[model samples]
Target: MIGALLVMIWLLVAMLLLLRRSQAVEVVPSGSPDEAQIAHHLLLDASPTPLVLVSGTTVRTMNRASRLLFASDDRILPPPSSLFDESATHLRHAGRNWRADRVEVGDRSVVALIDIEAEERTAEARASAEMIQVLGHEMLNGLVPIVSLAECGVAAAEAREGDSALLGEILTTLARRAEGLRRFTEAYRELARLPPPLRLTVSIEEMIDDLARLFASRWPGVHLSIDVQPGLCGEIDRDQMNQAIWALLQNAAEAVEQGGVPSGRIDIRATAGDDVLIIEVADNGPGIPPDCAHTIFRPFYTSKAGGSGIGLSLARQVVQAHGGVLTLLEPFPTTFRAQLPGAAALYGTGSVF
Candidate 1:
């Protein structure tokens, strides 16, 4: 009788086990494999751009593409609020052509995307624009001199003096414009051939102080404030970082020139949290115009009547090289932020690098 009871108990246990397995499969998405089996399936599917399947703030699973794309996070992904809260989502959709959709899988939310293609297209467009800016710069230089020459000829005609050298004025104007064009072309070439950062360990705080002092001297009228915590540093290319931050600062000053004091504030803050360092340079100026947000980082695309739009693009490239990111705070009191790893971490291809 005891032996018979034992056999019955075993059968009941087996049935309960089967029921649990069935429930697990039903709740799992059809397209998603068990995350445990991800290692063996790496080659089966490929994503062309950086893709991350972020569930809340945690990355439940990442395909090969995501691993490569968000490598710097190394171990932990950023907070959900950082990527897709109301503010981020609005900025994403407001002025850009990119898509950011939320998908429900099981009882959780996942963000799926191929962001790199959009990035590449943006880069290519900027490159084309820089080429055009160079051309425009050259043409204006030539035309300016010609315009001056024409003015001189008119003046000479009115003077009716044999010494009124119309040819001389025209030649001088043309020559001056030609020289202007040459200088503009030289600047274009330097931007085009900008070298990849020679990265090393450096304290970002020191860099900020350097910027503060330099800008204070340059923009005597503008207040350049710095609030960086102690012992915060990153593995970066100093020259590139300087160039990136300078671009943002210069843009901020320009944006506030016509606006009132409410737009005059440019704040730079850095905090070291856990193993990461996040830096922000914020301005209260007339934030990026809706249309400008989409193309602001593109090369040669400038909204300023006298500006060349290559700064932000270079900034983005520098950030990307550091295995980091630089993004505009969309619904902001007008801010730009950069997220980079701390000095101890070195970037790797499939990891954070």
Candidate 2:
């Protein structure tokens, strides 16, 4: 009887311990990371494209980019369906146009946002090419007859022994207009044919100083200041980069004049980054109108009367061909920023730092 009781008591203790272990296993704290969940989180966080997992309308979780984009505390966002239809539509968020898509991840849906800037650029390039072809066709056909007619008028007046002054004036005016149109079309064509940058090591500081002095001489009354980080340099096409900077400076100066600001100020600044060199041109002028912001980079879109509208477009094209980007910084309404890859980054030699 004593052995039996001892064995029974031991068995009872074992059962109790087993029961406690099972209960402990079942009671996982809410939201505790499992192997798969942790992996998904890491992948989403590392992805360049912004992503968010939504459980119905409430955002179950999101990566860093999502927080930066929404800028709101509410995790429960309006359904993606509201913003996007069956087809991927553009949503202007955070000052960029993004095409959002709904994707299924397990039972939940994830919203994937892709930036369409490159696509826009491709489209713009195609449109510019088409326009150039049309312009060339139209201008050639139109100018030939005008030139021929003007020549014939001048000849007739001279042969008839009549006063040739009127014909002379008409010929001169026609020639001037034709030349101006030719130059205008040529500018657009140049943007299309912007040569691949011939890269060479150049001091960015020198470029800044030179541009400032040149512009100051051109606009004697306007004040131009340069702030360049010492010992900063980049590998770039010298003449092309000079042209780009000159265009930016000229636009800023013109903006100041148009705004009619009493004390016009234009500031040029340069700084070196780990993998890129940044140059900024800012002016105290009436900034680009918000309404025209979308079309500002489009070829032949101009705000100024008599403006060819190709200056900014060409400047941007030149920068892009060099594997850099030129953008209008909205934070400073009249600021244009250019980011170009550093020499090390361009050549793949070593870290830019």
Candidate 3:
């Protein structure tokens, strides 16, 4: 998208240059508009970026993109001053963020609106990928040698004669811990290397039933319930979506266990809209701490002792890969919601952390 935008900008610049050259060499008839002017208008209408031409505060003309943006009536545009601040580069309009750029064209001012929200998300995802690569590289370098040495020590201790029991036991513990660390590192690496999901039409009710059964087997003490709309189905990566939902369920179960709730309960609900699917998991446990809320979704950020801290982050990544959003809703009962696009609305959405 950015590359296409850059190409459009270059084309606009070339058109402006041609217009200047035409004005310098030729003159059109007094009552008729020049060929350059006609071509310039055509280019403006063809541009993907919303372009508006205004004489002071009054909007003189706008392109198709601008008309769609502001929902203009019969090609009539709203006053520029009302839509955006002339001095501000960033503005929120029509429920989206935009980077506004103004250019002077003779007496009229041309305002170009560039949607920056998607660009910002792309930048954030890039930063996360870089961070994961660097951390994984550094940690694995140190962990691999430690794991190998621990295994060698364990073997050596077991082979030694007389009073080797204590040494062997200590070496075995070290080897186990080191191996666990290696597995943890590999899990995170897999998260960083997650591939695009393979989508399928899945039954929401059956999926919820599976999750409920799994949760019951894992935490028999905690009660689990499901409330899915009948015939609720969506086009999604079934395995990825299941993993994401399981993470939420496991997180809730752990929270309930940690809080020592006498009567723990978890509810999984699924509802469908015209072009979206909403899945929510709520638990009656000691909710997330106020201070930890911001960093909870961050990879490897955990408050629990010996926690892998990969569940929530992995769940979020999977949902995002499926062109969806996984969010922790605020307040009590500790609900996590995943909003996903249905088949009709599945195009153009990209994955992000």
Candidate 4:
């Protein structure tokens, strides 16, 4: 009877000890609610897209990017206007609606504004407006060409001289000029038709290798260096992402191709965090000009001479379409970083994206 009582007493003491340890646990284990929060810390810090958490009118949290975007938080917030705006500040855009509002949250300005359905809509409108202005430019490029040639051809025909030479020269020049227009229009089609990307579970390492191989093959003169993490891949479109990386590589190659810098170094890196992943491409070439830095991704903006200026913009579009982000960090040697959410978080968590 005493032994039995002692066993019961030991069991009771062990139960109390376990209860105390349970209370001391900081976060739930894997598959628990708190586990997800801990896993997403890096994403919360470095995500390129802005995120604002609100509970009825009280601002709960704003990430680093949201803070930088708003400029200042003290500015008054516009009243709620539309579901997209969620604010009442409606500035008449004449053709479209535009609004801006600011709120303060922990030393940051979170400006909540209208969420547009498409960037292509804006790009197409801008491209069309540019074409209207460039019509004269195109005419000038071609119109001056054939008059002299045609007149010479007629003179040759009257003199019983061979008209073939004059006619061929004029025809060749016209054909070349026409081909230029066709190529330009083709580029426009590529920009305007920014096709919907296919999303898949991609290992980040594989993309890095593929991009590296592509650049290595194309730019054999420039040295390519990749420091991507082997297992740190995420969900992204393989073809479009390959194209984006190719654009970045070309941009970097341009910066260094000239005779200024000794040996150009193109560094491609991928770092994966709990819930976020960042792929960075940095070049030791001449950094982007300060004047053109901010507008680099804007359509029709390019620092290069005779460059069509849509590559970076298209890259940005692709990243945005994947619910990811691409940004330029310009100081000395410029760094272009692409930030994307891990497939697991974006797919599993409701708040991800």
RMSD each, Å: 14.7, 14.8, 17.9, 22.1
Clashes of each: 8, 0, 0, 7
Candidate 2 TM-score, true structure as reference:
0.59
Clashing pairs in 3: none
Residue-pair clashes, model 2:
0
lDDT (10s digit) by residue, model 4, range 1-353: 99999999999999999999999988746778666776686667577554544434444335665455444342224422231344445433224444446665564445544434235578678867875665556556555654555566567567765667766776676677667667767776787787787777776666677777878888887998888665555677788888887888888888888626778788888787767778788888878778777778866566786777778988888888888899997646889998887644232333211
Q: How big is the positional error of residue 184 in model 4, measured in Å on the Cα after superposition? A: 1.0
lDDT of 1 by residue, 1-353 (tens): 99999999999999999999988886666556686467445643365543445554465444555455455433335533444452343223223333445566775555555354577798779777766876777577567767877777667666755465665766676677667667666766766787877876777677888898888887677777788876566767888888988998887777766555552777898876666668888877667777678777766667776776667777877787777888887625678888877554233322221
Q: Native-vs-model 1 lDDT?
A: 0.67
TM-score of each: 0.56, 0.59, 0.61, 0.59
Which whole-number lDDT from 0 to 100 does residue 160 have in model 3?
A: 53
Candidate 1: where are CA atoms >4 Å away?
A: 1-164, 260-263, 343-353
lDDT of 3: 0.79
lDDT head-to-head 2 vs 3, winner: 3
lDDT of 3 by residue, 89-180 (tens): 87778789888788877877777888898788997998679667757765776577777767667666667564666666667676776777
65: Cα error in model 4, Å = 28
Pick by lDDT: which candidate is best? 3
Clashes of 3: 0
Candidate 1 lDDT score at position 36: 43
- The residue-level lDDT of candidate 2 at 306 comes to 67
Top candidate when judged by TM-score against the true structure = 3
Extract clashing residue pairs from model 4: 79-87, 79-88, 80-87, 80-88, 81-87, 81-88, 204-233
